[model samples]
Target: MTAVSIEKKVNGTPVASPELGEGRDHPDEEQHTPQPTPAAPSRREEKRLDKSTDRADARLDKAQEREEARRDADHKRETKEKERQAKADRKAQQRADKDKARAKRRKERRTAWTSLQTRLTHHMPMWGLPVVLVSLAVGATGQAGAASAAGMGWASAGVPVLTEGMTLTLAGLTGQAIEQRRPYAWLMRATWITAAGAATINALGHYIEGKAGDPQEALYRAAMYGVASMLGLVLWWVVMRSKRAAISGKTADEVARWKRLGRRHPLLMRRARRVADNTGKSMADAYATVWERANGARPGEPSIREIRASRRAAYRRRLAQSWDGRRGLRKQSERAAAVVPVPQADTVGTPESAGSAGVRTPVQAPALPVALLVPGGQGGWVEHPVPVLPMATPKRVRTGSDQSATARFPQGKDAVSKRVRKSVHDDRLNTVRALVESEAARGCDLRKHPSNRAVARAAGCRPGTARELLATVLAERGITR
Candidate 1:
């Protein structure tokens, strides 16, 4: 059994047992004491720590919230600012647009004002007025000088009526020169009229004095004065013109105006298209003429009006299909028949004559009734049987020496010659041409017409060639479009 001992020591707790080796040095002491352990903290302490932690957390949250709020506020402010900026920009654009419109209006107004100013300021003289005034002045002045010179003679002779007239003429002439501002050229002409007037006045004054005063001597002196006055007037005119030439630069107001008025009048320009068109020619030719005149004046011959009228008449007649025209054509066709070969009679004894032999008059059938003569009988009925003349086989004459050529021509006197054959071909072509022309006149497109090839074949040419030839012939005659 294990012993349980208790021991106590100063400043030491009781030891219940001593170890074997350590027992000699110190008595054993035994103590049973449980260590004191701290209990769980109070609610208050836990609450304090929790509160501290919570406060830190809260501070962080508050900082985060503040930061986020600030950011949000900043974002809102930025958005508002952007909107405000947009509004401001719109307003600015509106203002700018208004300014632009105002500027345009202002420019228009300025241009209008400038135009008005130009019109308002523009001015020119009345029609030819200044010229007439100058003419009168020059005429009167020259007349006065002549009168003054002749007056001396009259004064010496003492004719009271004449003396007063000479003085009056001189005074009126001097007053006219200073008052008028007419053209110088007119003034020059005025000088001539004035000189003539002065000479006449002087002559009258002297004549009157010669009759009233010392009859014989006065009469001689009067004649001398009249001659002197005329001479003086002529000299005065020469002097004025020489002086005008010597004067340089443009004449004062009068001289400058005279220069302007001196220009040759320009010929009136007007459109000639109406007259040109009225001229008888193709419209294309007329238009070409107009273009020529408009560009350079390498003028072509003007279309003849008479020729046009004639062509128009022909056109009208053709369009109307006049009976006279048809009759004339029939006559032409009959005339053309002269070239066609006549089929000779095949009778054993009938004589072959140019007029007597024809297919239309059948020699074999004598006096057949007109009803029996008709082809494809009336009411589509069969015609009465009558012996009709057979087409005479063309007789060939052996004009050639060759045996081979003799085979084609029989021993007939009326055998066709090469020349005759050519003539017949020409006649057939002419007939075909006439037919083509009639069709063309009916407004057919000859280019595509089926008859055109046949006509061309008869014409011994291509279709286009035939058309070209027809066009040229018609155009030359000016009969068809």
Candidate 2:
């Protein structure tokens, strides 16, 4: 053990203590150093840290949610905008399609109206305009007079004239606009009659009613009507001449239209062509006449072919009737002949007619001797036993015109008939040849008209003569038939 010292200070003086020799240092001792104490966290700091962690997490969550909502809104807005745009486009397309259909119908009606007007203008009578105007004027004037007599409120002297004049003028203007330049002959006559009747009625009204309001005016109106009528006549004549010239000088389009119409109306065209051929008229004139007939004008004259066909039809009908009558008469005659008895010749009964009743009995001819006596003996000489005549012997005739036969006794008659026929044929050949030659020289096409009947008609010869002449001509031409 080691000794240790102790010291003490009391008040201000130093002092030593005896008991201070306490235990001293040991060899193995430990020393301890003083350390400061750690402090605990505050409540505010802990709360602030918790609040900051929570705020950071909450902010991240809020940002993610906002992004999701923005994406959703953008997608929804895009879908809604596409749907609205599609709806607007569909509505606009429907509106555009409806406007195109109404424009096509208006064009078709205008063309038809023009064609009708042209047709009416061409067909109506021209002279009827003035005549109808005059009659209307007279009728209106009479109506006004009647109204005046009845004490109507509309009755005025000027009213009648104004109405009459306006109506007549309108009618005249309509006639002119319609291009009426000429009337048919019958229509002209009717119009003239109507005009005369109107004039008579007007004169009678003026004279009887003691209303000769203005004679000069009446004369002037009459002159105006007369002048209009005369002018219409002149204009109609000029228009007719011009139309005739136009028809004669047909345009290409007119000619083509006519051709198309002719093809459609083939029968009418054929008739027109026939008329043109027979009457020596121009084909255009005949075609125009036929077209007019088809358009409701007077019918054209019958063609030569039509006349001939009618005549032929009538002749055939008469011939058929006569033929039927003749056939009936013949049948009647046959029946009468069958009903009546016929006389029979009486003779010896033959083997064929032995059993049948009312059959004619056939007579047997006697056989002649094969030998004949010549005039070697006198006429009064008796029949002597003559030798049998040879079959090859020829017969001789005594008369000048009698024919001689070179055949045997049995065939002599046939030979003589043939010789006589040959002589007659030879005599007819000369006259037939002359007639045929004359027909040939007259430009007859003998080959096409090689018929004997045709030759007979043309050559004024018999059919047999014509046939003989044809044979001769054919032989001359080295054309044997």
Candidate 3:
């Protein structure tokens, strides 16, 4: 509320005093006034201020760290998600591949089954004696009400099993006979005889017991027993397999010697027998001639040493020829040519007429043309036009390695086709696998005792080849030897 007048010289000039005109202070006067100096803070106050400043900086640093941590966690989560997706993709791919393979295999099996059924029908006769006996046996078992129930526990179950088993066995026998070009007719006949004998035995028992019911019931019991007797034939077959009859009625020692020789050089023994039959000479003499030819011994007769040398040479030759594909082809060609027979010249007259010295005129029929010998379209000899055979086209045979590739991929252009083919892979070495597997399925252990020898015999291959194939199969199956 009080006013004081003050004067100051500014730049060597006198300053002016202003009167209060309004409720505002003079801007020039305020700019010229000197303000009071601010006091410095005490040590405690400064410390408190410094602490507050430090806390603010720490809070900002914590916020930045939290942001960085959050980013790192996000990055880890994203990386893990990507890895999981990759793993799942791989598993899905593997599953898809397995499914495709199974589908392809099923298709191939279906086709093979169809082909097998067709082959089976031709090889077996449904109306044969074997079938009749089997039917009769089944009918008897079904009709033998009290007989089956009073027997052992197995009897009731065995009736159906035996029926099915006998049927399967017959089918197998038919296949074996046809595929192996062997005769099983005698075995089938033996089965029938056993069945008949069993029926007779059963009938006699019923008659003796005075339990003979209706004729039909008696026959049923007999038929059931007959089927059971048929099993005896199977046992007999097994026994016969182990016991070999004397070869051509030779003595035991001679047969033993032949077997020993056959084991080493089957070809040599076969040639000796063939030569003996053709020349009407003794086997010993035929063998000696073969030895002489093989050894290049004397022009007249060879010594003991030369004969031994010839035997060794013949063995080596046989082994070498066994591996020679060219030699096998040549032999096949020769056999084919021999099968096409050529007609012999017609005899001018009978031997009796020529020997009698008769001057009678020989009545000769009109000569037939040589072309008449050729087969016609109807598979019969034609006297008019000669039938001409079409030229055979050569087929490409895949070798071992090529066969593996072809079996896997087949010949295809589409990707799906190629994939399907690759899914069901195979190997050329599996050519004998079916034969080996069949024997194994029949409870044969070709890997023990006889080892490769048994497998080779069953598969129709050399022992060495069988061993190699067995190794490959075991390797594929992940089995250790």
- Which runs of model 1 end up more than 4 angstroms from their true locations? 1-51, 123-481
Model 1 lDDT per residue over 11-129, tens place: 34443333332344344555334344456678899899999999999999999999999999999999999999999999999999999999999999999988866532221123322
- lDDT of each candidate versus the true structure: 0.49, 0.52, 0.53
| Model 3 segments more than 4 A misplaced | 1-67, 83-178, 183-189, 199-481
Candidate 2 has a TM-score of 0.27
TM-score of each candidate? 0.20, 0.27, 0.25
Off-target runs (Cα >4 Å) in candidate 2 are 1-241, 248-274, 277-481
**Pairwise TM-score winner, candidates 2 and 3:** 2
Error of 3 at 249 (Å): 32
lDDT of 3 by residue, 1-481 (tens): 7766555455445444444322236555443454344566788998999999999999999999999999999999999998999899999999998998898899889989878766544443333336545555654454243335456464555544554455446545644553454666575564545445445544444433334557767666655554554554454343333223321455667767767977876776777777676646577766654544343332254433454468578766554433211234455344334333234456677454566666775543322223334567877876542222222333356566544433223332234334332322232155346545666678866454235665454333468877877777656656445
Best candidate according to TM-score: 2
| Clash statistics: count for each candidate | 9, 0, 0
**Count of backbone collisions in candidate 2:** 0
Tell me model 2's lDDT, rounded to 2 decimals: 0.52
Model 1 deviation from native, Cα RMSD in Å: 33.7
- Tens-digit lDDT track of model 2 for 252-288: 6775776696778888788677757654557776766
